[model samples]
Target: MQKVTFKIRRFDGEKSWLQEYQFPYHPGKTILWALSYIKDSIDPTLTFTASCRHAVCGACAVRVNGQATLACETLLDKMLDRWKTDTLLIEPLQNFEVIRDLVVDWEAKVERLAEVKPWLIPRDEFSKETGCRQTPEDFKKINKNSDCILCGCCASECNKLSSNDRDFLGECLRFCVSGK
Candidate 1:
């Protein structure tokens, strides 16, 4: 087994700091697995969000080597191979307030989505059994947009929102709004 070093930016409300962790490299392991190992074995106080480990849920989003991505979707071997280093740097997503280590507040996005009326409001009255109907062609129009898991990756990478500016509605919300 090889040794890998992970440098993580940790936040605890009042302040934030960088913390280093060491892990035994295993082929084909994802970044999420390494993070889990760190939290479970190395530091019990560490915190992050993860759900639907298969990537369907967007809860495990974090910045890896300065790129916004999902931890579960990022393979450790691939990242090391691509970056040509045994060290990985992880931090909370950009344009968000960190609530804790690697966990950012999603309330802003939720609020924006609420403002946009993200779901369809049927004009015509319909029964519970009749449900809303849509043609195949109509369904296809929003199919791609519907794939968004609201992971905030697009928002984190957006040029419109830097650390200084975060009042703008993110791409994820725009996509969801358009899908309606």
Candidate 2:
């Protein structure tokens, strides 16, 4: 068995704390798995998110080191190694608000998404007229990013947030609204 440590941030609105956990590592053991082990064995009070553990769900996204990533898909030892120099920071994404440990208040982000109208304008109008065609070539262009689980990984990495600017809609929003 291998041991890896997670130096995570704990916050409850006004208060903040930091803690580390050493966990047993197995092949393909992801950050989510380690966290689940900690939650189940060490501290049941620890809070995080996980649904389909297979990365189908975006709920498990969190910061590893300084970059946002899906906890379920992030390799434990590798991520630990990546953050070994500094604290393996884990916090809720920025640009919104925090709900609890590793979770954010995304209500506003959802609201903004709703504001985009999401290509529905063409949908209703096109349906009333003749059929509109789309080719596989168009689909393949951004097919990978299209699978974005709303993880907010790309959003957290942008420098605009630290700079405190609201102009940038962030990558996730761009991915959703832009066709190309």
Candidate 3:
């Protein structure tokens, strides 16, 4: 295809709309690259969040055609092939308050996490100066769950949380604290 089109859902705090943008297509480009190109070359007002371009940071997570995926890790060609289309619909993640285009409010999520107190309480023997030490085997048990970057991808895909987030915390938070 000579060009790729993005139907991006935009929110201006008070209003929401879908805007379409088309740009020259390049091989091996990622969803994040398209967003950056649109923002830098076409519309300066477009907004999104991304950091640590690698998948380690979850800041770039967004809903691509109704599914949550990390923008940085998803390739445009792969998505096009999967959907068999040159157009893609990009929107903010579900089960969260939208602050703006592709930006969701994380303040409440952080507050919920804080309420659970997801931290290790060292034994009395382990003082503040020395710190608590864990064996390699002990650390390995929770290593995978601890890798959660709170990108809200799991929450977006979760049926329970999507139905009622106020009553249920996302799996990310649950797994993150379960290790503690």
Candidate topping TM-score: 3
Q: Model 2, range 95-180, lDDT digits (tens) per residue?
A: 65777777777776777677665442344436535665556996676566566677776667767766863665444654743444
Poorly placed runs, candidate 1 (over 4 Å): 163-167, 174-180
The TM-score obtained by model 2 is 0.77
Identify the leading candidate in terms of lDDT: 3
lDDT of 1: 0.86
lDDT of every predicted structure (CA atoms):
0.86, 0.70, 0.89
- Models 1 onward score TM values of 0.91, 0.77, 0.92
> After aligning candidate 1 to the native by TM-score, how far in Å is the CA of 125 from where it should be?
3.9
The best-first sequence of candidates by lDDT reads 3, 1, 2
Candidate 2 ranges with C-alpha deviation above 4 Å: 83-87, 122-145, 174-180
What is the model-wide C-alpha lDDT for candidate 3?
A: 0.89
Q: Candidate 3, residues 33-90: lDDT per residue as tens digits?
A: 9999999999999999999989987899999999999999999999999999999999
